[model samples]
Target: MPVGEEVREAWRADLDPKIQAVRRLARRYGARLLAADGMFAALSATARPEHWSADGVHLTPAGHAALAAAWLRLVA
Candidate 1:
């Protein structure tokens, strides 16, 4: 089942700050941050809805592949 908008919003409110903190710390430490959230957001904006799972919290197979590709681009 799909998650409710309220739950989704709550999760974002809780997690977004932590993600930003990690990104900031990674930059401070001269470490590479994968920017997975950004990648996912971009994909969600441009790609078809099938990339995400029914619950909207997890990724489907294509989404995982896309994330892997993004990671490869950052690492390679």
Candidate 2:
């Protein structure tokens, strides 16, 4: 199963660096990445195993498409 938010919350001190890496990727791509308290809260509440694979990780093709669409909407 994907690690639940409860467990993730317990390890946030460790997880932050990894999340920062995502921010770094956004910078490398010249993408605007905005992190907010509400974004984290919503993600914690709505993140699902279905978002990924049997290993409960990585974006599926549809996930990539959705991300692309969101970026398009923001940029356009």
All candidates: TM-score: 0.84, 0.41
Instruction: Name every residue pair that clashes in candidate 1.
Output: none
Q: Write the per-residue lDDT of candidate 1 for residues 1-69, one digit (tens) a residue.
A: 767779879989999999989999999999988987777777778865545555666788887788788
TM match of model 1 to true structure: 0.84
Candidate 2 TM-score, true structure as reference: 0.41
User: Backbone clashes in each candidate structure, one number apiece?
Assistant: 0, 0
Q: Which ten residues in a row have the lowest lDDT in candidate 2?
A: 48-57
Candidate 1 residues lying further than 4 Å off, grouped into runs, are: 48-50
lDDT (C-alpha, whole model) for all candidates: 0.80, 0.59
Off by over 4 Å in 2: 10-49, 52-57
lDDT of 1: 0.80
| Model 1: ten consecutive residues of lowest lDDT | 48-57
